[model samples]
Target: MVGILLQPQSSPFPLLFLAAVSPPLLPALGVFSLIIILMAVTIGDRLIVRGMNRFRVWLTPWFKSQPSPWLELSWSLLQWGLRLGLWLLGVIGVLLLPASNPLQRWLLLTFTPVVNRLTSLLVTPLFTLGKATITLTSLFTLIVVSLALLLLSRWLRNWIKQRVLTRLGLDRGNQEAIAGVIGYLFTALGIIIVLQTIGIDLSSLAVLAGVLGIGLGFAFQQLASNFISGLTLLVEQPIKVGDFIEVDGLLGTVEKISIRSTVLRTNDNLCVIVPNNRFLERNVVNWSYANPQSRIHLPIGVAFGSDTVLVTEALLAAARQDARVLSHPAPSVWFKRFGDSAYEFELLVWIDEPKDFEPIKSSLNFLVEQELSYRGIEIPFPQRELRVRHTEELRLLFNQPTSPAPTSPQRPSQPPIPPPQAVQSSFSAPGQFAQDQTLRVLLRKVAYFANCSDAELRVLIERGYQKFFRSGQVIFRANQPGDTFYIILSGSVEVLSEGQWSPNQAETPPLAVSIDPKATFIQVENQVLATLSKGDFFGEISLLTGAPRSATVRAVEDTILFVVDRNALQKLLQEYQELAERIAIELAQRQQVLRELGLLNQEDESNPADKTPLQRIRQRLQTLFSLSDRPGWPGHA
Candidate 1:
């Protein structure tokens, strides 16, 4: 080449100048150009892919519906194939550059032999085994196949866990177990298939396996133990997913169980990992194993002088107040022992949700404290003592003169306690429960419920809510939809409206009163239309007729009212058909009284059909409660 350049014409200035700059760099420069071309092709491929991805949302509208999984996967493979083809095309374009371009011609000449030599090397056999030979291509195939097998196994496991086993009505543990077993089987079979396809003789790998096995056995002994324990957990079905388990004083819900470890989500929302073998080896307390309900014992200590009976009552009251405490089990107080400074007692209560252990225990403690304080039962505190060697020194300290302590101001005297007999007044009937006796007696005063049996009244009491109303608390307001019926058990309530009574009226309210037509229900006047006391009831009119409340009723004092809502009345009317007619009659009487007071329209006089209001109320009750379909209802078939 140098001799030709010495002659005249073959573009000596370009090649000669290039060589003159750096003689050794000339060949290396061609290699660099080749590398630059390959980099450009790779960068362009990525840029094209990015551009296509950016337009994916717009392209999605072109398809009528979403592509299936296989179609989507094929599309992904096609994109990679296109990228590879672009690289090949880039190399070909460089190779096809005309001979006139000196740089392109030099690159072609320099890289062609190198590419051929690499190809020869790839095809050359590294070793021959019986009929099977190993080469670079075969090794590359083996690596690709191994990676493909792993990916396929993972995908199969996920698919079975999510789609197949999930729909088969299996629990999460069973699903995970089945999927994991299938995945292992599939991976093993896949390896065998790949090895056979790549022409690898399994018999020739025995010695290699023995060597690897010798090393792995000692290295992975603990790992093997954990794996076996995990498999045992999956098979034996001890603690499952979502089980509330306590191991070594650490309590949490089981979230995941893998071959190596188990994930436990604690009450504080912390995820902890414990080795699988630890669960098998250690004693585990499963709170939510076969049954989630478990008994919780609360150890309580009261001051020594406190009444044991009163302390028991307070503890029982606290447990009864808590709805989480199971009623059938009936919480009991056990007198455990007489401690040094306190009497030890254990409150044995059963609850249905063991996962709520901490919260339920805390709530019970709060309730116990409140009940003990209410009954003036003192909770015991730990006693601390200090010993001094000199008795004369302690006496001298006590006898020392000190400034007189200023007297602390006393708290205002508490309201006088009501007598126990005051609570068990004429409002109670024979054989009535102590807690709800007054309510049952009050309920009996209502004409419609006079004949209710003990069991029926108990049902009604269970269904209705016993709510407390402080003085000045508005029970219901006029023109509001009347959904609740009230039966006063112990205190009094006044029925009034947003109007002034006529001046000429006597102790009785006048038939007409002056009132603003647009006035809201909150503005009740000083005039009280009626003062209802113990065993008296109100809200029956609206409850029966489905009309808005005619007047507002509020507590005259701190009152306990047995409140039965419209749904309870509806159910009661359906079950006791006779009660509906009696209630209709009661509504008529109330409406008549309203008419006499000029609150209701005066001329309903029944004109001549004096039963109009009663019939209207009955029709409304039937419509509101759908009682016409009830079997024993008179209005129905």
Candidate 2:
């Protein structure tokens, strides 16, 4: 390497010093100062970041109601574009320095040869064709042009859909279709023009295109099919947005149809993304297609000998009473068949909104029951006449001493239902049948509910809901609303009266001044009368009368319970007609106990002498559930 002789003649200052300070030295300083000032203004407090944030804030409100993908893309482009412009300005500043300056010389020396070599390599042809030659520059140009076109296509598509088509008042599907078609046209034409501008002959690329096409055909076959299907959906408009449809056994409203997939919002508020092709391939049920009216079937069964005419009239009245049931179609009743233990009929009512079907059916059930009860038509359970040829096993199960054969060989005419044995077992109160089985199975096994059919039991299950309670959660407090009742399905609960004060906790009253630690404290809590576990059921009597509860029930641990509210309880009582009186008697006794213990709320003070608890409860039940009227009982004046 040879050392260059000092050129003091070129500049008054040393060449190295001149290089460090840069050239046209006085002017260079001024330019650098200007650049420094710009950089300081741009970088201080992160000017770029703050500007972006301010832009986002300003743009947010304009598109607050709906998201804008085009805005997001444009914002990204602006950010990158600003950075590129700043960098270009910096490079121009450096290149503007005097050539004799070492800094400028060094930069030129380092990059000029590489730049020249690269230009030669990139501009030279990699392959020559009859009409065009392919070079690195052309390939690079194609890639960059494709990317630019991609962005342009997206931006245009979104603009047309959101700005142009929307103003035309066209439907969303039509808007999407138009936008997509425009986008495809732009993309196709853009690629053709770019290829021709770059001197790439379309004819020369045919064989290569064919090979690529075969490979791409296999790779994106489903993608292409789904895209085509999406286009067809937008054009045909078989299932429009907001139309309720069932496809692939999934029921929902159409949310959006994109290029490849369609979105559906289900009744549960879940968004399901289904491929567009599925709509074309599978059978779709559009309930809200043209006519918004649809018929719903409510099956009714009553005691075998009930009058069909009254049944029909009751059903018709129930249907007409509800505003939701359309009158134009006219509700019709069809006698389906003679059920094993009852007459099976279907109540067909036309409804306008299928989405409200569940609620409509539920309300109609209450009305139907009211109408049937008004006419005293019993909706009886399927009576399974038990033929016990041998009573020995049942007798042993009840732990009864084997009794001698019945005197005089009495004919068993639907042997009178046995009373539930008053459970004297310490597990329950003095006279209560301990619920030791599940609600459904208990209904089947218990003697009081023996008349209930499987269908009626199923109704009980459908009506009640299961609830979970953490340890120490109070299920019900004494004197709270007694409309709800609980049946322990998987855990234990404590039943306490309103009640004996057990000293389980203590708290001192705060004084005017700081209280001493030794201050006297008093605490009184409910006495835990009993701990009842799984299969335990309570609150039936309280639900019947809607009276104040006489006891508090608390969960002993993490527990699951089947809870039935007033309406369901009323229905259950109505189905088990014979058990209602017994439940009333039980409630009366519990109320007496509460009164004696001085736990009764003053609001609950009653003249017990005028009406027996049983009579009061029955009358209350009649008013609450529209049960059949019965003749005066023993205490009814």
Candidate 3:
């Protein structure tokens, strides 16, 4: 090792005194002074550290707001510099003392060797730049400075991209494009600057250019394609950061577009990295490309004998019932074709947002089914008849009487229209249905049908269907079909009032009603509108107003419900038109009560001055029953 050499200085100890003493005290004194200096330096470092900790607390918020690692390093350097300055001042003060003083002589003796070693140049100079010689130390310093400059340049680039370009109102694609270009340009410039600092001539790199070109041509073909594709995407703006897209059967939202890869976030919250070249080469469907509106067609089929006009009207009503379906465009029902056993139809409707595509389509399909069922229009399946010629072998096989063939179960047929009957007596508790007697009694208990005679009640019983639900069971979700009205017979249910429900929002797990029906309890996430016990009913508003469900209803216990759907009510209302006035009054009173209880919003509040509740109810009933051609009626063909 090349050790630093110091120039000889005068020793403070006298040589004759050392000879007299035999054992020298100067070495021991030097050792003691080193201990004292070390102790002072350690104490000074601790004090400086404590002060810096306090200062950091004060500056934490400022640093956090504009967080950068370099800022923290700068602060640390300042602290150490202050500590070094304090040590230097103390040493100078000791040195300034009188030459004859013992403390000055000791300080000089203890620190002189350390000072000389640090100042010594251990390596020979390599070259000269004007007056300064380029040595190993200078070269190392240059490398460190170059690295620091590169880091600073990167930090600046990111700061400009995030803080300045973001606020310029450019599209996200453009921002990323500009930022990527800047990064490449900065990286190249930094390399050139570093080479220049090292005294390397830029012109000397020309010899390797041909070799590099050949390497890139053979090894980086795909990389080049992706880079060019990325530039094309940025320029064309075919898809933005928030655009919902489907490319090569992968569906997701565009999150980021880099030079080689594009990042996508799926609906299930998974990140996908796709090559940029694939987007340019494959077919990509941007759902929200230029307009957010999109049309949905739900194909349906009904029995051949069903009324065409009625099917069209019912389809339109189902579309109109949904709040998400756009009305200005006007939903349409087209008669598509006639199959062997059924008449094929399609319900065409438009929605405002492409994101609502799946949910709206599902909702429309459900409504259409309910509407068709309510109107007694049968959705038929493909059917075929088998013809067998009675040959001798077939007849012999049939006659040999093996076990009978198992037959496929058939779907239950629509109930026959019932003849009016006497009102049946109220039955006992649930889980026991004696004929349709219990259901008929439950129907009579409902407020809407309290005035119905035995004949009207029998008509309802014929048309209604009975369902049993266990506790904590969700009968239907909020904002689903409201085409069916339910009346509790023996048990109870809870009405959970919620804002307009969006399926994409966080959902509660399905209630665990699989165990003991009476033991299960559901914690309502939304506000509890009301609780309904025996003889109480819900879904009247949806049935009467033809609106989506206003609230979710879950069974509180093992409950039996007599459901009266739209068609049954429409049929009964046509026969007993006088019941309309009473229905309106009852519904209006319930509306007022619901509003007072905060279950209903201001939009659904009654305006008796504009139109009497009775008149409005009559108009709605007429539209529902196809008894009017009013201009504003949605049921009009």
Candidate 4:
């Protein structure tokens, strides 16, 4: 074996030269090279492993924090890159070793080749498999990850804006835009990083870039316009969320503004999608842009004879009752037109929020109706009068009465006339007969007393008293006992009350006082005036309860009254419970009006002061029925 090793082989250089290069020098050089290579491989492997470990650690938090599939895919790609690099280097090192050297050959053959082949085989399959796996992983990740990041960044930005920036007194418009920009920037960064990790080299995509650019230009023209419009909106702030706007004739609340569109929810609960371009181009009435305060104009018409000052005051009072209306600016009513049937007026009131305009308008309408009705101001409808020209022929046709021929209608019997003495007697005792006769005539005209027999009305008339008042007389006081109820008879009269009187007596009467042409002297505190001119009755409430009068009555002019005694009223009520109930309802309505006018201050018996009505009812039920501490009835605590 020694001789065989010693035998010389043919070479280009001398044997001694070969010996000098091959022996100690070659061995030392190889050893040094091997040491360097091993050290490099060891360090490279350690780096790869360390990076993989670190990435795994990083991914753990990312996975837990985000639960996004994209991050997981990125982590997997990093691991693959490190493993691939380490495997390639190991294969190269093994292939470079000399096969003739036993130690080197054995080391290469023992572990190097196996590891190299295993890694080499794994490289292609793993890469292909990894690519497929990551493709699916990233696809799913794109949806979930994008959504998650978008929500997170949006929430964080909004939090910062509302909590930090807004608290710092920053302009809300600028702060919102800034927050949106920051959130979008974060989303873009995340997307770029994710795509890069997945091996999508944006720099190498020249053809794709051109295609994308053209496609974007064609497909996203509106999108780009909306983006620009959004920026314009941020800068201009023509409209904002919570603003009441009328855009393209659609009135609604500006609920949300996005890049491409603005969402408006109308009063009808319909959502309207308005394009940004349209918003910029069309006339947009942003009632709250420059000023959040808006003016509400309510137009009303009252009968011509209605007291203008009283009507104005009632309108103002109604407006004042609504808390939304501003007081300092004050409500104003303008007599706009003298309509044919009614006096037209416009009420202008200012409110703080434009959104409240509709509700305020509705409330004002209700109040106007109630107040006007209370004041006896007639809201008249459109009236048209026809003047008929009667020709001689038409007059003859109306006046002519046909006489029946002898066959069926023979001759009508002549009616006998009363004697001169009877006529004289009837005329001579006019004063004594006037009371009963007037009441009997009135009972026939009054719808409420329509069912009463002539006998009953005659009784009522005899028992009832009568009085007369000059213009401007006190009829009753509020909160006084509900005594005599009144029916108006002859001359016009006014209904007045203490609350209606001005606090400063010189200002004006407060009560809704009206000069009713059909009305006569009104009933005062406890008396019913029966002989009001033609067809009026009073003291009906007294007949029911013998209670004091709830309202005062005054004569606007010289007025006549028929007073019904308390005993007479009670007797009538005792005979008819239904009549009593109807009177009670009427009294309740009157009381409600008095309460609204600040004249009546009676405490509601249904509602206790200590607890809400609902609460009181709940407590009563709990105590009486012994209910457990479970869910109580709705609206109860």
Candidate lDDT scores, in order, read: 0.71, 0.69, 0.67, 0.60
Specify the poorest-scoring 10-residue window by lDDT in model 2. Answer: 1-10
TM-score of 4: 0.41
lDDT of 2 by residue, 106-162 (tens): 668888999999999999989875489889999988876787787678668878878
Q: Rank the candidates by lDDT, best first.
A: 1, 2, 3, 4
Model 4 lDDT vs. the true structure? 0.60
| Candidate 3 structure quality by residue, lDDT tens digits, 137-210 | 76776656665665555556566667888899876656766765676678678867776766656665565567
Ranking by TM-score: 2, 1, 3, 4
- Candidate with top lDDT is 1
CA deviation > 4 Å runs, candidate 2: 1-28, 35-37, 40-78, 97-101, 117-169, 203-206, 316-325, 356-382, 388-637
Better of 2 and 4 by TM-score: 2
Query: What TM-score should be assigned to candidate 3?
Result: 0.44
Q: Over the stretch 1-637, how does candidate 4's per-residue lDDT look in tens digits?
A: 3222222132222232233233433453456655566567566656665666665564343221243454445444545555556655654563365632554454466788788876565444222222233344456556666666765665666677767877888755557667766767788898877667666565655666787988898889888888889767755778766678998889998766667888788988898988888888888898877667778889999987876765765586578668888864556777899988999999888898786688889999998887776555778999999877868878899889998756775668887888988776675331222333344556555444566654456445434544577887766555566545555556765444333232333443323444343443332233333223335555454333334555566676787666655555555644543443343334445655435544335555344554433343334333333333334432434
Q: Each model's RMSD to truth, in Å?
A: 16.5, 20.4, 18.5, 27.9
Residue 172, candidate 2: how far off, in angstroms? 4.1
lDDT of model 4 at position 285: 91
lDDT of 1 at 16: 30
Off by over 4 Å in 3: 1-171, 178-201, 328-330, 391-637
Off by over 4 Å in 1: 1-85, 93-108, 123-135, 203-207, 323-330, 384-637
> lDDT of model 2 at residue 42?
45
Which residue window of length 10 is worst by lDDT in model 1?
3-12
Q: In model 2, what lDDT does residue 510 have? A: 27
Could you tell me the lDDT of residue 124 within candidate 3? Answer: 59
**What TM-score would each prediction reach against the true structure?**
0.50, 0.50, 0.44, 0.41
**Candidate 1 lDDT over residue span 56-116, tens digit each:** 4554543323544544554455455566577667656545444225655666688889989
